[model samples]
Target: MLRYRILKLRGDCLLSLFLLTLIFGLILRIISLCRETFNHEPLSKAPGGDVEPFSLLLIVLGHSRPSSLQRLLNSLSKVEWLHSRVDLRIWIDRGSPRDSLRVAKGFIWSHGSKIVRIRKVHYGLLKSWLQAWPLWDRHDYALILEDDLEIHPQVYQAFRYLTSKIGSRDVDGVIFQRLQDIPCGSFVHFASSWAPVFSRRVFHDFVGWYNARRTCVPGFQPFVPGHDKTYNHWLRERRDVWSPWLRRYLYEKGTVFLYVGSLGMVHNHHERGSHQTEAPAFFVHRKIWPKVEWNRIQECVLQNSPVFECNNTQDGVQCGPVDGDRRALLRRGIKGFLSDKLWICGAPRAV
Candidate 1:
């Protein structure tokens, strides 16, 4: 009888162990399913049916103030035209503060935004840009903006007009913001990294040159002190290279960089963020115009001005009038018309 009891006890123990193992495996499977859903779940469907996607890659430092990032995200969300057309991705550098990550998570939850948090190491401005170039593959066009910028409402409209009107091969990219010295509505050969719209082809060519030189490291190019300088150097070096194809595309074909002569499409808030020692002086030129003035500018550029074109020259493409002589007249007319219609003194500063 005792022997029979022992055999029954052993069977019961074995059955219990088997059941526990099955339950543990089921729990693990459930956890894995949850993880897969979180990672691959679709946030929102593309706004329009059967339309291609455009991407806006906003690069932000991990240590940047959350408030600044929040403000920028809020401004971007306000752009109604970007609702369905643009896929927003916030690229956070490695070693970013937890607070910054929290802010990014909030945006992701609220706006159905995507996040790419770099792991292992921090990539400064130069390397960060190179890391982002691959995104062009998934998008029809890509616009790169820093964290401290507030885009104008008409930004998407301007980009669409430029992309369709100016074939991607004829131009390098369109600058959404202009320097204080650059005239409104002028096409220049120089490329500015701040808020520029890039085509896949141009992006490929630019990356090709960088890869050939192997200047992927931040400080490797000793003379290239900053991102703008690096691009300027690339243009100059490519211009000087003996390759006939380079010359033809840059000079002969006049593949010049384009700029909008209307009010700026983005305002540089110059918040004390990454790479800045202190808040830089907020020049009036960098400020975005009020909505009324901005609308007027957009109307003139989209309707009144002719599409700007440039030809490649031996000395590189020269900056010239976008619409021949009418450009100046139009600029004068827009300024005078707006000045008379609205008081310029008390316009609210762009956020």
Candidate 2:
């Protein structure tokens, strides 16, 4: 009887081991499939698949700094697919002299490639993109980047995924997933355009929108919001204004809204002396401008003016041209210390 019991126990142990091996095999197979599906395969590094040609419209304006520009170029170099095929359009700031731009050209050319085209336009941070309005027909998608962003290896994958998911809709904008606001407790997800990929139709919509309000939000306005400033306000205001329209228009057109980069791989560095700068030393306190009163004032201004010029004055005295020059110096100095810090990344700094 004891011998019979031992034989039964051995049989049970063998069966358990076999089951464990089978389960392990299933897990490994699932992992392999997932790896194949989600792993980035740039066209330059892709396997036996038909190469999809992607034309890049990269714009760099006054925001360009040497360290930041170097970082941008480095990250862009990792884009395996569009190495030689990139149709770059660099719009240097008008304030940045021809000599500065020439130096920029030399810097860009040193990277084993040349910018397919270079256009010098009188554009600040926001005006840079505004200038591209006329030239939107040059590509499938427009990549509007500041000089300080270093993107991830999977940047192309994210773009392709967005294009596939969003389709050819007019209102469908792909948000390139680098955000300062933690919308939820997650590694990555999409909400809206922190860095947007503009399609042709969407570009037109932006132009139309800009044209309609361009008079109010003119290019040279001192208070013209930076990219993050615009994004934050757009998010806060879009639920009542743009979001529903986007959902209806894109959804009706069979395109879905998507965001990528939950891992924060797209790093936005605010190099000092760039076009993006914070308020003067005095504009950093909350008691000076309470949120409730500030919102009320903002609503009043938006409703009353819809578009108005910036107040480049203090104590009823014009700060004049010297203010801009002084601010430029401050901007350059701050860039080195605060390049990748969140204090100035996703939203307007207190000012």
Candidate 3:
């Protein structure tokens, strides 16, 4: 009887082991099938098994302070690009320090391609900042950066997201500004050459409008709701200044410059020979992240331009004046940042 009981126990153990093995094999097979069906090609990839990344021109303007320029270039070199290719165009104004020229000319860009433009005559800051990026057929978007500041590693990521999400047609371009009132994210009337991104259409139109306004538009009048004495004075007096006219353009045409770097992407060193001498609390607060929390940036994008020309001014212009309901830019709409037209690579992947 005992022998019979022992044989029964052995049979039961064998039956349990066989069942466990069969279940484990089934799980492995199911997992492999899922991976084969789902993980073949991610939606982020471009077609033809080659990711044709988005292209833009990084027009780096430098004239002096080799250290500042080098720091900025190094920061740019360390940019974490996901699917964007940046072609570098370094424009050195004439009469620049030889050290600065050496730093720019000697630097090697590994990403896409590079072109260094050394002007015959000094273009100065205004012309260098304004005209460094022309209506080049080679590229549609241009990010004009100064050598006085160093950008965060994820600066490209912010630019990528903002360039893709154009909330309104009247958006002049994306700018990297940190406002005093709305610290997180908001649009502004100010055309800050500080770290502004301009599209081909906006820049093309701006060139014509700027020429006309600066030439024909008489008497630098105060345009902002409050006392605009400083800006108006700068427009009239400062010939080498460019941002004043850009501010005028947005003010008159009622366009908005998208501000995504409200949390601070640029660390302005305010080096010698730079325009910005007295760095404000806003500009100095250069808080950068080691690894960018994309979700936080997405929230900031959604929080963009709650009001028209959402600056520190007192106008309180509502976004109703603009084209669409920008507040509808919840997570439900965008799968990811698309092209300026929101067409290419804007849709969801197939189920």
Candidate 4:
């Protein structure tokens, strides 16, 4: 018994020391990565002239298709950070292919931090997406990038401009999809191959409303443009798709997402997921992307950029020209959006 206790004590000491080293080493690695990726770029200045780097948060979701995942990682590595550093959180769904885990673990981020998690139980896509994104995080902006798309080098630049430059007023989310450029920007209501990114405020409201109304999802109708169902209602039948819920939240809240249909920051590599392309939309401009004057980022203001206002239609929310309804957007806040019924819906579920 005494010998066993002695051996246990030594093992505990070694374990503690190993944990300390790992923790401290991670801290050092973060510092090193920040300097390597961020310092070389021109830092954005705060009003007080304090230097701050633009921060990007990326939530990458994958299950299988290791080659697709690898292609994405390679593009990420090649991206020009511009004024931002990345916080990459890759969450692979449960029962993922063996090659997927190996691919995720092998890739390293040049800038900022990267985390890879493989769940033990099979949660499919919806649970994995809902659970992976934390309510609180430290980043200037965030995007949910799908695994099957290859990113363009200037993708981050486009994201920063769209969200911060224009989206600051009301564009709560932005997405890339295959579309013939509509004169007015088309709102992406479902799965897009490149995927969507919700602003901090919009996402918070979505989570709040979703938690409250989750139980009512059976009867809940998504407000997406031509958002529909077959046999089982959305959340019940389509466990893999989560955007419909978000669409429901946005419809009630009356917010919108702006996307330049012609500009594909990400190219779809596979036949699966939400993409409408004979070839991915990005391929159209890939050859001239190099010659394209990035100065257009500055030239394109709210008027030129596709800004959408939601209007009620027989089908559902329709994206059209700017209308009076724009003011009704998230200005109400989550507290205003929740109701007694919604709060009641959550109570029984909590129990």
Candidate 5:
């Protein structure tokens, strides 16, 4: 009987231990759910109201190159003028190396910049741009820079000058870098992925058009294949034919994209790209503005009112001189030529 009693006691003890373990597991799961809920609380509820007037959103598109990304970030950090006003958002696409994500997060924390959402799934260039478009709605201006580029020291000054003139000028956006093959011009003839600054209105319009047409064309994939001449040929044709219509639309609405001639405010350092392999000779041969030259230009811009003039050599349209017959041209249609040599000559010469 005593033996039987001892066996019953042992069984009871085992049952109690099982119940205690199950309860503990349940408690841990509940705690985990609560922690997740707390971490994901929306930014709107977290003490910050509306965005600042001069707020700038810097969106960095990062892939698997942690070292390259670190260099870009370091360059940006050196720009004291930009550091305070700019909030950085680094989007780490799926399949990116774990090291890249770690580096990006560390940079953000070190800089005290708020973490923008990290993407889990891989969205190629086109889709990622589309997905990130909504972020512009919250900020006054947005600057998109790929990981492979570095900003010039005077970029912030240039941007400030542009922002100051934005109210009076019908400038929608500005490309900060000069392409190697393309001659320096105010109007962009081709679609460029180089660092471009866009105002809220420009961002909205461009993304709207992109979203509508990205899937409209059949069998035209958004991803550009490396070493595939056929794909490149198709892309060129599409841009040359269909893309101009979008430019025309923006032009008709008094929104023109502009670029600084010859004065490159950013440097492209990528050796290889998804679409094409860049020769080392290409970057070596590219003309870059020296620091002293950029300083002189900045001084000139700050001293006098910056003039927006059309470049007859370039195919795209530009803002005409403030006092010229070109105003009439703008009123009449998107295509107009200003034949005033004095107005063009009086504008700041590109170094």
Candidate 6:
């Protein structure tokens, strides 16, 4: 009888263990589903099934300027056209001061509906960007904006226009604006700092490449042929501490250079005293960052010279047509006329 009782007890214990295992499995599945939903969940809906499924991630550095951020927030609030177009996620550095943290929290809370989350972390900008990478998998497109940006009202319209225009085409990337002084209608295969939109395919591919090749090369070279510009840009900016495999990934398959568009969304705040001293100062006092700064960098790269000059207007330097002949260009063509031919939007008689 005792032996029979022992067998029954063992059977009961086994059944209980099985039930617990089942419950644990269910819990894990639920957690995973919630994570996926949070990451790639549907964005704000529009009528006619045209709503985009993307996340606009605003990654603000801990030491960002308040006035600049406030202006950026104001722009965000006044984005009337894209009322329900994106899911906004703001990632702020948690190691910031209490006051800054409160302000960041306040900003997130105020836009509670659109704001998916306010991730607080203790890291620098580059690290913070990596921290936000997981969220990218959940989004169709991601717009990585910094705190100190002053965007034009039509920024959203411009971004939507580019995305629709560049659908699945293997161009580098699109930027609201660029620092390089390429011809007005130059073709780009990439994007820049302002408000860049990345399809999931592009993001995954580029980041995957970046991961594999970021550290291998000693300084920076094209991960492969035709991609020298992108890799070198990182080298110039002191971010080339990646592996050779990452470099190779970025430069692979004749991905020569990424292209950019000449719309206006991102503007530098160097005049407001936020000069990125960490980066080699390329632009002079009067030139715009995108129009003049990047071109100088490019010139140096082309010449294979570590440092180059903005000597005159001919080589698309800082003193080039954009600056030297703004008024003439404004009167010369319809495109120029439409551009308002100025650095910042709505500036007083700039052209």
Which predicted model would earn the best lDDT? 3
Taking all chains together, each candidate's TM-score versus the true structure is 0.56, 0.46, 0.66, 0.68, 0.57, 0.52
Q: Over the stretch 212-241, how does candidate 2's per-residue lDDT look in tens digits? A: 433533331111122234433444543222
Query: In candidate 4, what are the lDDT values of residues 1-351, reduced to their tens digit?
Result: 999999999999999999999999999977875554344445664322334434557888876667677777887887776544567788887766888888988998866667788887887655665665675464545678767767767766665665555545455566655344343244433333256666666666667776656556555544343444521244455445666665556545556566654465667655343322243322222222352345554444355443355333445435545443344344432343363234444432110
Listed per model in order, the count of residue pairs whose N, CA or C atoms clash below 3 Å is 5, 9, 0, 0, 0, 33
lDDT of 3 by residue, 1-351 (tens): 999999999999999999999999999977754443223222233212333234567889987667777878888888875545567778888888888889998999876567777889988876776687655434556778888777778877666655455433444477675554553456555556566777667776666765654455454332333325545555466545666556544544455556675657776666666465454312323335467676667676554455434433335222223344433322212322221222332232110
**lDDT by residue for model 6 over 186-250, one digit each (tens)?**
33323244455554555566564445433542333433233344444454556523322333332
Worst 10 residues of 4 by lDDT: 279-288
Compare candidates 1 and 2 on TM-score and give the better one: 1
Total backbone clashes of model 6?
A: 33
Give the CA lDDT, 0 to 100, for residue 318 in model 3: 27
C-alpha displacement of 15 in model 2, angstroms? 98
The alpha-carbon lDDT assigned to residue 2 of candidate 6 equals 100
Q: lDDT values of the candidates?
A: 0.50, 0.41, 0.60, 0.58, 0.52, 0.43
Give candidate 3 regions above 4 Å deviation: 1-54, 165-171, 183-185, 215-227, 274-290, 303-305, 308-351
Best by TM-score: 4
Please list all clashing residue pairs in model 5, or write none if there are none.
none
| Residue runs of model 5 more than 4 Å from their true location after superposition | 1-53, 108-112, 166-169, 179-190, 214-232, 236-255, 277-289, 292-295, 298-351
As a TM-score, model 6 comes out at 0.52
Please give the ranking of all candidate structures by lDDT, highest first, separated by commas: 3, 4, 5, 1, 6, 2
In candidate 4, which residue pairs clash? Answer: none
Model 6's lDDT to the true fold? 0.43
